[model samples]
Every structure is written in structure tokens, then in C-alpha cells.
Target: MTPKVSIIVPCFNHAKYLNECVESVRNQSYTNWECIIVDDGSTDDTEAVSRTLESDRIRYIHQENRGLSGARNTGIKNASGEYILPLDADDTLNPLALEKMIAVLDQDPDTLIVFSDTVTFGHTSKKSNLQEKFTLKELLLGNKLYCTSLFPKKYFDEGIVYDEKLRHGFEDWEFWIQLISTHRKQPITKIDYPVFNYRSHPETSMIKEITGNTDKKEFIYHAVYEKHKALFHEFFPSYISLLNRKTFYEKKLESIYSSKPYRIYNFLINLFR
Candidate 1:
């Protein structure tokens, strides 16, 4: 029997892009799949848009605003598939993404996650060539696994859900660290070609995170480090000192950037860029 794949799309005021996102899933080369659209208290036309998409395979669920993590949790709770893929509202997957990823997991029982390269669109247009191999240390430094990756239902079964408290950003990065740390031996598959299309735009959460206040960003970084302090210290003890230095340097840079002289210099630099 072919295992069913559940594509959980958590939407919050992304009604404009919902149709294109869902259509990408519908046009997938693989057929045995379900697309669950979890609306997170959108004041827009998300409900009406989702209602039009109702079908045997495509289901829509609405809940109060709980942020991205909460919305994804709602979809996970209602999903009925052996494999899972978390597709964002504005992003999309390649036509053969499901078929290719499923094949890898089917052949290798030891594999825990299957991801692929991403092609950036919208504001930016380029193919991202990520590292082919997965390493716990490299992942600890930064997230290489896109959220659209496919994994078994065991993650949810093991009580692993996105950290809702990370409302600012880096929730997916923290989730990946948490998931991979527990199952250190299991290998992660990364396809060479692009299998996901990441839409980057001014209104995107990433831009908000990037342009956010430095102090708040630093706080989140510290919070994440503290949350997974044990894992970091255990696997890579050397990183602790490096993290401390990084925090210190960031503080110094923040102070410098805030100074009047630095502000004037930055303004001049931006003019040239």
C-alpha cells in the first residue's frame, strides 16, 4: 500500500497566495496525498478562499490566531498520514517533490528527514545550493533544512511540536535542532536539485525578523541558546565559548551602530549601495 503524505499549510492573512500554494500541491506528480489548510484567525478572505478548495483530499480548519507554530500544531493534530510536509502559505513545492522524497524514505528506513534545495522567487530569484550532507553541528550553527521537508509522523508521535513561544522568528531552526538532537544517529536526506520554491517579499516574516530591533533579536538568540543549553554543551562544547563571544561582539556592534557617528557613516554607505 502506498503511504499517504499530508501537506499541512498554516495560513495567516495569506489569502492572496493561498490559491497558488494549494494549486501547486494539487498539481503534484504524486497523487496519494492530502492538503490541510489551517487558517489562523485571518480577518481577510481566507475562509472563503479555503471553502472553495474543499474536497475529499483537501480540508480546511480554522482556529483563533495562535501564531505559525500553533497553526501548524492544529494541522498536525488533524492530519492522517504516515509522512508529513509543512508547506508555508506563500511557498510551493516542485511537482515531483513528494514522489522523490517518498522514494528516499521508502528505501532507507534509517532516514529521519528528507529535504531538497530551494529556488528563491518573488523579491529574489535564485537557486539555493545547500550542503548535500546533514550534520548536527552545522545545523546547530544555522538552519539548512527548509520547513517544507518531508518526515515521518514519528516526530509528532514523539511529542515534538514547533515552539510557539518563538513568535519572533527562528522557530523552525529551533525545532530542527530539537528534533535532530534526540535522534542523532538517524541520517537526513538532501536532494541535489531544487524541490521547493521559497517566496521572499517585503511583507514576509523573514524581512520583519531581519529588520527587527537588535536587542530583541539578541534576546531571542539567548533564549534559544538557554532552551537547548544542555544539547549544545553535550554535543559541541567548543560552541559555548564561541556563542559567548558572538553575543559580546553583537552587543558592541549594536552600541556602535547606535552612535551618532556610526549612524552618519551608515547613511553615507547606504547611499552608495
Candidate 2:
């Protein structure tokens, strides 16, 4: 029988965390799932480590280092299950996440995306962020969907593919916007439990993109802002008003040397650092 869900993990130079991610999925309380690890041309031992898994349910695909969006699209293309769960290489899902999410999907056939709260862990700290039912405006302004959330596989086939051109950030935000706009009526629900553990590390792509380097941040900042401004304004006009007081793009270009350029400089710096 076809697996009920397909877990697609995109890996790039994260050999250290890939095994733990796989172990989390393998230990899932639910059994009817397939794990697809798309090795996005990692110049590390990621591929070799994934090959060590002996389960027939595990399928490994290797591709050139396409950005996160490209790697996710590849996973969508190769998925054979009815549901798709995209997991970050450095993150792991709670053992009961699939079980709970699947139960919800079964109860409501019209649901498109189901997400859960996440426990974010760094050096010596762990904190939980409760997932709330979000409006398109909230999502466009700030993405709350953790990477391990469950989504309908067909939603991907019908909605927009990840914008591979966005090499650094906001591709997920863009794609989610497209989904919300096109399939505006589909229901999105949030499970109460912390079903995802987001590992915080110095070498994560998002961290490296925002903090350690500033050259591409301007592009990413405006790229994300421009893409969602319309939707964001539709729901939260106040934010747009605040933003228009001074063009973020202009400030970004002018303050190339300023310690912090964006209003949410802390977030922008952390996402790319």
C-alpha cells in the first residue's frame, strides 16, 4: 500500500543533524509513512550517512545545490504519498506529530495545511512557541508555520512550486501566500502540542544568511517585503503605514554600513546570519 504520508527532508552540509532528524521520523508512533531525504548536493558526509539507513521506506535523492525552494520542489516531485510533510534537515518532529496530524486530516477532508507549535532549542535553552490559527495577513507579515507541518500533497501539485530563484529566503513565505490566495477557502488548523523541535545552530543557512553576511540581506529583506506587501496590507494596513514612513529598501541600500537597517533588524540579522 502507498504510505499515508511522505516526509521530505532537504539536506545541504548538515551531516551532523541529519541522523537525528531521521531517527525522529523512524521513531514516529505512526507507521504508515515514507521518508524521502533529498540530499541537495551537500559537500559533506550527509549522503553517506543517509545511505546507512536500511529501511525500505527510506528513499534518498541527490541533486545539485539548488536552494531550499528548489530542494523542496524536488521532494514534491518525487513524493508518492497522499500527504507531504517537509522537515528541515536540522530539525526533528515529535514522535506523535504524524499521528496527531493525520488524525486531524482524516477528520476533516477539506483541511489543506495542519501545523503545530514548536520547541526551539539553542545552546542551553529551549522555548515553545504556541501555534495559533493565523490569517493570511499574519502569515504574510510573519511566517508561523514550522517546517515540519503537514500539508496535502495535492496542494503542492496544484499550488505554486517553491520559487527557486529566491536563493536565500522568503520562498516559503511566497509559496504560502500563493496557496492562501489561490485556495483561499481551504481550512488551516493548529494542533496545541509542541510537535516540532527546531534546532538552533550557528551554521544553519538562515543564520549564516542574515548575520555573518550583510551583502545579500537587503535583497532578501525587500524580496520578502515586496512579495507579501499587498496581502499584508489587505489585512494589516497599519503595518504598511508604518513601513511606508520610510522605505526599507532605501534605508537598506543607503545604510550598507549601519549596524542595523531593518526595523526588525534582530530578526533579519538572525534569519540570514
Candidate 3:
């Protein structure tokens, strides 16, 4: 028997896209699945839109504004399927996504997570491929995994909820770090082709929070670093040393760039160019 997949769509002021998102799930080629629509206190018509779509396989849950992590946590808590797939309300998955990712996990008992490349739409149209292989070291530097990855329900069962405190952005990235580090570090599989469609828009919460606020971005990065400090020391001690050295040089360069002598030198160099 095929394992059932629970697709959690967490929505906040994204009612317009909810229909399309749920429809994509409904159209999945794989038959064993359920769609859980979680409305996170949207001032928009999210509740009404969600109410219209509830059915046997599709269920709706409403909560006061808890942000993305909180909304997802609620959905996960209510999900009954063996596998969990977090699909943002604004995004849609390919028809074969469930089928392929489920196959990967079913075949390999050692693999704990499965992700895929993404196709960007909405304001921008491009195919985003995974530039590097998935490794703990690479993942620490930056997040290559989308939030819509497939994984077992044991994460929730074992009390692993997405960190709701990370409201700024990269909450998913932080969650991934926590998921792999504290848990028994299992192998992850990434499908080569794109199985997810990401909608990129100016109003997107992540884009708005991360744009033009360098200080906030740094704060989030440092927060994640602090949260997973022990994991870093355990897995990539050398990389931690390199990061500290890089920070020292960056501070030194900032001082030099602000000095009158370095400014004069830079002006002269740019004049020649």
C-alpha cells in the first residue's frame, strides 16, 4: 500500500491563490493524499474562500495570526498522513511531485527528506536549479532546499515544530538546520528536475523582510548561527574558524573603507578605470 501524504498549505492574505494551490494538489497523479488549508488570521477573505473548498479530502483550519511557522505547525498537528509536505498557499506543486518524492522515500529507508528544483513564476520567470550538491556544510552557508520538501511525520511527532520566533525570514532554513542536526542525520535526496513552482512577487513576506534591511538580515543569520552553534562545532569546526576569520577581515575592511586615505586611494583607482 502506498503511504498517504498530507499536503499542508499555510495561507496568510493569500486567498486569491488558495484555489489554484489546492487544485494543484487535487490534480495530483498520485491518489493517496490529503490537502490541509490553514488560514492564519488573514484580514482578507481567506476564511470565506477556504470554507467554500472544504470537503472529505480537503480540510480547513483557522488560527489567530501566528505567522508562517505557527500556521504550518497547526496544519502539521492536524495532519493524519504518514508523510508531510509543506506547500505554501501561493505556490503550486507539479502533478508528479508527490509520486516521485514518495517513490524516493519508499525505496530508500535511510533517506529522511526529499526536495526538488523550482520553477519561478509571477513577477519573474526562470528555472532555479540546485547549484551545488546537498551537504551539511553547504546548507549551513545558505539554504538550497525549498519549504515544499517531502519528509516523514515523525518530525512533528517527536516535537519538532518550525521555530515561530524567526519572524523576519529564513525560518524554513533554520528549521531545516535544526531538523538535520539534532535528529539522527539521515541522507536526503533531491530530484534533478523541477517539481515545484515558486511565485515571486514584491509583496512576498520573505522578499519584503529581507530587502534593504541589512541589519535585520544579519540579525537573523546570527540568530540561526547561535541556535545551531553546537551543530556547527560538531560537523564543520574548520568552517566555523573560517567564518570567524572572514568576519574579522570584513570588520577591518569596513574600517579601511571609511578612512580618508583608503577613500582617496579608491578614488584614484576608479579614475584610471
Best by lDDT: 1
Q: How many clashes does each candidate structure show, in the order listed?
A: 0, 10, 0
TM-score of each: 0.87, 0.81, 0.85
* Candidate 2 residue spans exceeding 4 A from truth: 122-124, 203-208, 211-218, 224-242, 246-273
Candidate 1 lDDT (Cα, 0 to 1): 0.86
Query: How do the residues 70-111 of candidate 3 rate in per-residue lDDT, one tens digit apiece?
Result: 999999999989999999998998889998988898889667
- List model 2 lDDT by residue over 1-273, tens digit each: 799999999999888998999999999999999999999989999889989963789888999989898899998899999998999988888889899999889999888788877887865357666456677666665566766678888878875678887887767767777777777888988887677788876555575666456566556656766766776667766764654554667566667655554547767878998
What TM-score does model 1 achieve against the real structure?
Answer: 0.87
Residue 123 accuracy (lDDT) in model 2: 52
lDDT of 1 by residue, 141-234 (tens): 7788888888888788788889999877778888888888888889898976577799988664663764466666666677788898887787
Q: In what order do the candidates fall by lDDT, top score first?
A: 1, 3, 2
State the local distance difference test value for candidate 2.
0.80
Query: What's the CA error at residue 100 for candidate 3, in Å?
Result: 0.7
lDDT of each: 0.86, 0.80, 0.85
